[model samples]
Structure formats: C-alpha cells, structure tokens
Target: MRPDSCLSQVIGMTFDASVCDMFCAWGAGATLVVPARRELHRIVDYIVDRELSHWNSVPSALAIVEGLGQLVS
Candidate 1:
C-alpha cells in the first residue's frame, strides 16, 4: 500500500492503542510510532520491529532526533 494509506490506518486506530508519538505530515496522514526515550523503549522496539514508518518531528524534537540520528529519512 501507499505510505498515505498506511498512515491513514494508523490514524484510525483508537487512542487506547499501545502506540504513542503520533506524527502528522503535510500532504499525508499521521504516522504512529513510540517516542525514543529510554522509558519508552519497549514501545519503540515494537514499532521498529514491525518496520513501521513515522513522520519526522518538529523543531526541538527534530533536533533531538538529528542528534540521535533517528530522524526518518
């Protein structure tokens, strides 16, 4: 499926779902993944092991990702 389609599926998920750190990109729907904090590793692992994609964060978070080299693309 297209990236947008995958993102749409993610956004339709219920809030109670285990996923966290939802990022919405322009011209596309939301990309769901877990935050990268150590405490959130389990969730992050789950998303990464599943090979899911996510939108890049904005500003401060983006800087963090860049520093950590985890920025998508």
Candidate 2:
C-alpha cells in the first residue's frame, strides 16, 4: 500500500536493531509506538486498546506473541 494511505493507521513498530527503516516508515505518517521491551502482552494490549491496525517487529518479538498465544491473525 502507498505510504500516504497508511497515515490513518496507528502502527506499533519495534526498533531493536534497526532505527533507520523504522524512522523512515514513521516519517511517512504511520503512527509508531515503541515499547520498552519485547513484552507481547503489553504490546498486544497497547495495540488493542489504541486500536492499532499494523505493527513491525523482529522475529524474536513475533516469537513472544506466539509463545503467549496472542498472535492476531
């Protein structure tokens, strides 16, 4: 999708090792929320509570979600 089209979707993106890519994405108008750690429960809670539509994370972060059984689709 076009970057401009994602302006309305509040996206929670993790910046563990890479900052440039994440920053560029955020600069394109995607609302970004960076958590303190790889806390899947907290991340999911934040996303759900804030009604976020997208997220970007490392594979390890995805594993956390899987381990907690909180993967949404």
Candidate 3:
C-alpha cells in the first residue's frame, strides 16, 4: 500500500480483522478511514465519498454488501 492509500476500517477495533486493517495502513503509512454511525447504513456512499483504495472485511460482511447489490465492478 502507498502512503496516500485510503484503507477502509469496516470492522470494529474489538475484532481481529481490525488489527490487520490498522497495521496494513500504519505499516505502509497509509490513511485509515473509519466510518461513523450514520455512514454505516450507507457503506457504499461512504466508500465513494472517502475514495477508499482498500477495504478489508470478512466474507460474511462482503456478502451483506453484495446481497444489498452495492458491490459494483
């Protein structure tokens, strides 16, 4: 990841996935974008608005987004 890469922190800090999210960005000096409460319901909008370059999450989380028809090519 580049220093300017905007990586999304979709998982909570309590979860193990969050560790990777943080380290991946911090290790490479990239930007880690954490979503707010309001933005949670509109993940796609937040992603676009934030211009996220990377998103890290579990398969189920992705399934939720895909099921919502929010995953665009």
Best by TM-score: 3
Score residue 66 of candidate 2 by CA lDDT.
71
Task: Please write out the lDDT profile of model 3 over residues 1-73, one tens digit for every residue.
Answer: 9898999887888887689878999999999888877886767878889999998777787777788899899
Which TM-score value belongs to model 3?
0.82
Candidate 2, backbone clash total: 0
Clash count, one per candidate: 0, 0, 0
Q: What is the C-alpha RMSD of each candidate to the true structure, in Å?
A: 8.2, 5.4, 1.6
**Candidate 2 Cα outliers beyond 4 Å, as residue runs:** 1-17, 36-40
Q: In model 2, which range of ten residues has the least summed lDDT?
A: 4-13
Q: Give the TM-score of candidate 1.
A: 0.27
Poorly placed runs, candidate 1 (over 4 Å): 1-47, 69-73
What tens digits encode model 1's per-residue C-alpha lDDT throughout 1-73?
Answer: 2344322123223553323333333335434343335533343344556465643223454465457666467
How should the candidates be ordered by TM-score, best one leading? 3, 2, 1
Task: List candidate 3 segments past 4 Å from native.
Answer: none
What ranking of all candidate models by lDDT puts the best one first?
3, 2, 1
| Whole-model lDDT, model 1 | 0.40
Cα lDDT of candidate 2 equals 0.52
Q: Between which residue pairs do clashes occur in model 2?
A: none
Displacement of residue 47 (Cα, Å) in model 1 is: 5.8
